[model samples]
Target: MLLNLNKMNDVKKTFDTINKIVADWDPLGVGETIAEDEYAGYIPEIIQVMKNDQSLFEYLSQILANELGRGFDSTDMKHVEGLKSICDKIIRAYMDI
Candidate 1:
């Protein structure tokens, strides 16, 4: 019972981290809106990855980083790196779960 509770807590924390990353990347919000349709596709994919299997988390993270990088100015390495950092955090949190 205690172990189950701890696992649940970990899942919740992981979800919260994922949510933060998604919100940060929301096209309608502060995030860039370059590839609006493509960006829309990512949320569902993220949720699917969250459900289907954990082994694919790294792939999802890389795809997200690539999509985010494409949305920003090509010369903006700082912004691209920041987005990649967010992806890294999401991947780390997912792994923790």
Candidate 2:
């Protein structure tokens, strides 16, 4: 139906926005030199957190610690806070749709 198609389009839009957020966050400092999908691997996990109403910051912290072999320290407080805000922003964006 047309309604379903419209909803799917909205979902895709949200996904694309989230994808850019992850890449723009650029935790690896690759900047625009990397492909747009460079952070695509994290998209599903971010979506999962949004769907489950879970804490993205916690999930991201786990990923950084286990997958990246790096963890935020006191000196990285700003980056940590930015991640937290991104979590809130994602949830709001998804719910608003």
Candidate whose TM-score is highest: 2
TM-score, cand. 2 vs. native? 0.74
Mind giving the per-residue lDDT tens digits that candidate 1 earns over 1-97?
Answer: 9999998897567655566666656634555444344354455456556543343445454664565443444357875566556556656667766
Q: Write the per-residue lDDT of candidate 2 for residues 1-97, one digit (tens) a residue.
A: 9999998998788787788777776777777768356778888778887754346777877777777666665358886777777777777777776
TM-score of each: 0.42, 0.74
* Whole-model lDDT values for every prediction: 0.56, 0.74
Clashing pairs in 2: none
Give the Å error, residue 97, model 2: 3.7
CA RMSD per model (angstroms): 7.2, 2.8
